[model samples]
Target chain A: MVSKRMRVAANVKRGPYATLTLQGEVIPSHPGQFYMLRGEWGISPLLGRPISILGEDLARSEIRFLVKAVGEGSRLLHALKPGETVQATGPLGNHFPLSGWDPQSPVVLVGGGVGVPPMAYLARRLSENGAGVIFCQGARTKEDLLLLDEIQETGVTPHIATDDGSAGEKGLVTGLLERELEYQPGAVFACGPEAMLRAVARLCRGKVPCYVSLEAAMGCGYGVCLSCVTRVKEAGKVVNQRVCKEGPVFEAEALPWL
Target chain B: MAVNLAVKVGTLLLKNPVMLASGCCGYALEMGEFFDLSLLGGYCLKGLCAGGSEGNPPPRLCETPGGLINSIGLQNIGIEEFLREKAPKLRRVNSVMVANFYGHSVEEYAAAAEKLQAEPCIAALEMNISCPNVKTGGIAFGTDPKLVHEVTAACRKATRKPLWVKLTPNVTDITETARAAEAGGADALSCINTYPAMAIDVEKRAFKINTRSGGLSGPAIKPLAVRAVHLVSKAVKIPVVGIGGISTWADAVEFMLAGAAAVQVGTALFSNPNAPLEILKGMEEYCIRHGFKDVADLVGAARDFERPDCNLPSAVIVTGEKVRK
Candidate 1:
């Protein structure tokens, strides 16, 4: 992967959320793949933070990222503005496998908090590929939900859940998931906090094929660092798989969530 | 005038002083997509053991101020797999290849080295002595001078290739281990591997890394590495290869000025895959600006500033028969 210094086309912030659109030569990316982003801030933070691809405009050659200002790095990213340059190395890691599915079957995409971006992108891709799509998102409150309009623009109505009952459902995103599974989706794709992913895995286990994107503190965002590893069962034995290399997307059954 | 960046460590000569440190660059092939691997002075593959390792559990890495901590446990494909799969491809690269090997015992280190002796692509053997000796009550082989000598001597006998022993900075006195490796007939020495360190998660009241403690590397360790290289280079006659938190050409120059014949780029590779090449370019620019004909002239340049005698006058005046007393 190449590290490029791209100019920020725009940095739009709303509430606790921000979206950065980078203007540079398009680095071909697929849904669920991520880039390691670092602001011009010096070495205090050290490593680049991994951000998932929100969407790509191939014609415009613009790549966007949805970031939440939860820490120093994200806060630095939040403060970024137009014309500022940022270092990004990507499109690293394995992506969500979109092929081999029956186009007639519905595919469910679930996300929580900042994890909603990639799912939104996946929703659009799945819909374009002729698969029926459903998007489920969860957040702490109404203002915390990310990319709702963008997700809906993909032509899929987003089922949202908020902790404070300020949004669609007054419960966890899994509550909406339970109701959606009644339709018997052909597959499920999810990304979010560990608790929500575990819940999604439990709900979809053995019933429908499920893929979940995981987040870990990453160093290289490549195979070499071995920093972003997750435990998974392979051939009846548990082994460590690199989240950046083997997956940020993995078959839910393959993971040892318990 | 062209700047000469070539540096020699024993019989092995490098096009430049910048190399990819062990454990940071995987087999050299993974990084080829980012930059040309041949641009580096050398490439030290990840630490290899007798058998393939799955490494530690999840959360193998975490970041600290100006640095990062990694507990990968030296995950690597077994020696046989490396030879069967990776060595042939690595041989085609123009850079010098140094295999960094570690083991839980002296015999295991020797056996692994013996297996690699026939591989023509491997220009040298870098013995990573940080692993704990299973037969020695779990004390790390690098912490004791005797164990360092034993491991070095055992591997020295197993391979005809130049042997470069990598010493850990977790020791009480780094010079002792440097001396021990030289006495063991080592051709060269790599000083200051990662410092043993740990971090905790306050929210969970637990360790951030799965293995609890790991090696700390990055800009934070550069000063400590320079000190180690300064002391160790003075204690031994063999060329010293400096490693530990070298991110830029200035950092590499500091190591050379402190007495390192060459330097290795480690954690910085994660931040920028082009670090080694960037450092090499900066080194060339630095040599040209300073009017130095050769980069080797920077090695051990600080040694002249050492004050060995406290009683010596700072300055002596001589004015024909009126010299200051």
Candidate 2:
């Protein structure tokens, strides 16, 4: 069952989809927990799709989603009128634990394309905990860049990357962070393309502890179905882990990224 | 309501049959806290190797209309550490635990199986033979029946537990590889692993998976799984496991009717955790609704020997564009 008190915050677009913001009382979501907003149905009617929990203004009772319109479900979300009602399910999935994170550590934040959305929230959370955050994100082009205003508002310096020289560095997001590593960050938090994350995982191999958020197209966003498994390094075995229930977030170097 | 869903895979029974396929669930234990492991059919841990796999670079996964493509190159933590940390808690799992093993060579498979066999908690082992032998010529041992035979034999000798050889749909004859596994004394068979496929992010001008190629699984791959399961079931003596894009109980029933002894939900589980529970309930209801006392009656129920011999007629003819019947 879902709460009916949800309110629309914003309906905007970037690429194939429109980003939707919802204002609802905090159902209590961790960094990676997601909310399913759509017509009154499960997956059918292809209703509004699930989006990564970008950030939560727990005090204000609002949450944000960086959605890409890859299909009919997402496309329909663009038509959601502000102030209109929606049926949303969760605050679901696992969240990154800030429990033992050392606040004084120089946290290197790495994200790619829309993956940058969650990292922004992570930076805000880490900053609140007293950690210094350095953010990095990449897109195929400058137009693909998302939420620059909200990010800039956080006051954490951001390093940008695009496939072309449309904005920031010309290469990939990995390049921007590699050069910045000279300054020596103590920890790294990343989410984005696995290839890029794998590269970052290798770079963080011996340098710092890396925590990465993997993206798996999820269905239940719970633990039962084994659909969203990502491989992780557990002692000697590269174990397949579920991104939905286990983590959208994990130790970067700890995951078995090829 | 949270449904209680669990099933057994051969002798190694599970709480439910909704397991984490090889590439879907990373490590066996990553999601332990999110759900009650006791409720799952059983989950196969990530693939493994003797050495650390850096895997291929960049675009690792790409999304298709109904599924996704991934070429993570069987990136593993090397078998040694997995035993030290994962084995202990895994053995204590409320449900069955299966370790999915992969290797770049026959010896690697042998070593991984032998080592994993020693773990008491591991209920069974799944062999993904179609994976590219990264250390060798970068090809799958399953593409040829001979390699599949050799690989299965080596792995069989290395373990005493129930072993399931996962077959690839890339081969001309999936049954040929399945027979090879049977000849090699494999306890069972899981067909098919994702088919060889690729997707391009048109905007980025890049392949969907970082490897420029990857295995495809999801609803789109469901039809292929049904075909493979039918062929292998008819050819082999051991139980046949069906997998593809199983997202619904109705889909599971279809696989069972096509001769899958049990079905493994891959891409469907990614979409919904409660899917397996729903499927289990559906199977039971189907048994009751069909007036069958046990669920086994559903296996291969759709087989029609009258269809111009044993070969299944094309559900939809592409050439003439008509059903054969």
Candidate 3:
């Protein structure tokens, strides 16, 4: 819950994507938990951008984020250099649960574009815990694929899909999930574009338990400003849940998908 | 030298002039994770009604240059849930709690006020008349002076707690509603709600928010808010609570100098959850630097400078001592 200035350790850029590392008294974060990061100090862009935890090294006191220069707030973050300061407020929101998992079944992890960071972090945690892991990622092209070396460093080679057939497969990540579902994966966890997650949720509907991390344009990432709410069906009633508070992650079945 | 940061809005005394605007800080519980709630002068809870609302659809916010547009549609957990769930936790927070509520009609407003009246944790009631009137085919209650007076009087009769009417800035003359609220037995007036505004995404060829238009708040609206406070404070005899894009201590001081008895920080809390306490500290430093023994003395201080024959006070003397007293 601490909000303070943390010095940037490095901004590793790969095309338009960046893996930003910050060194400071970092807040310990769980997989799927995020930090509200604002590059520099000003009111031009009023609120902090919610960035998911790409990696955390408590030993080094460093936190990492995978950022895409899509918007003003993120462009500010992507432009940071080593020794620059960032206003960080976190380990905010609920994290992906690692309990009650069956050790024998393969844990299928799926990600798309900037949404891959949390899945990468989750993959590392699950593998370290001695759980069977399978990773699937999709992007528009080979160059658009983010954090490939980082995911490979986790000792799990990703089953990649590119839109233009420049990588592993030439289809959406859901196509890979459809193939993996035959192996009876214990659980499906995904973070990606809405269309891909929706397809993943559909593919694993009755066969396997599925969890999807959500995203929205947020004002305050701390539950006050109700800017990032998505509809969830609870107790047979549809209600809005704040992505920053109730979750950036939810059981896919809880969501009201059309 | 010591400085007194306390100020009174009607009979409701705040330890300082720093309060979190309604619908901005939620119940102040989330903010407590970053800082202690007792550090604030007071906070207006999110707007509530009887049955609660689902609010608008997805994409409720849009960011402009130095400002934010939100169409949250007053999503709240309703009075029953607030009283049963939030109120008990808030009772332990030690800072003043103001219940902000709204309704579509006069009777609904009165009923909502009465519902919150029995809660011992709530010190004051702020009536949000910016809601559309269902009886009048969606015309806003605060937009019309008559409706403002009617609704304020109805709510005033419903509760004996200190009543503060939050005036909307969509009206042609904000002071008209301010005076109406005062005449209708409002103890104080919260001047200037968010200005009606909109934003569109060119790429998507769609509106930024689900609701095509929303209310704008942030530094962009500060100057407009200051002018509203200045006019409304002069037009009404009761205390005026300034709110609109106040992000810093200097902004709060500017509101006070323009004749606001107290000021509320809205969108600023989104950027910095520690803003209220920070602004409070900066205000204390400002009082010490300006040689004013009391922060309340700064209210309407700028207005005194406009007088022709008045004897100007020295730097050591506190100006506008008689403005509020």
TM-score of chain A of 3: 0.97
Segments of candidate 1 deviating more than 4 angstroms: B131-139, B303-325
Poorly placed runs, candidate 3 (over 4 Å): B131-139, B303-325
Q: What is the lDDT of residue A136 in candidate 1?
A: 91
| TM per candidate | 0.94, 0.67, 0.94
1 against 3, candidate with superior lDDT: 3
True contacts kept of each: 0.77, 0.09, 0.75
User: Which docking band does candidate 3 fall into?
Assistant: medium
Model 3, span B1-325: residue lDDT tens = 9999899998988999999999899987888888988888899999889988878787889999999998888888999998998898889877789999988778889999999999998999999976421223123888888888888899999999999998888887787888888999999998778888989999999988887888889999999999889888878889999999999999999999999999999899887787888899999999999899999999988843455587665433222123421
> Scoring each candidate complex against the real one, what DockQ results?
0.79, 0.14, 0.79
**Which structure is stronger by lDDT: 2 or 3?**
3
The lDDT values for all models are: 0.86, 0.71, 0.87
Q: Enumerate the chain B TM-scores of all models.
A: 0.91, 0.86, 0.91
TM-score of chain B of 1: 0.91
Give the better candidate number (2 or 3) by TM-score.
3
Q: Write the per-residue lDDT of candidate 2 for residues A209-255, one digit (tens) a residue.
A: 77777776554455433435666788787766657556777776666
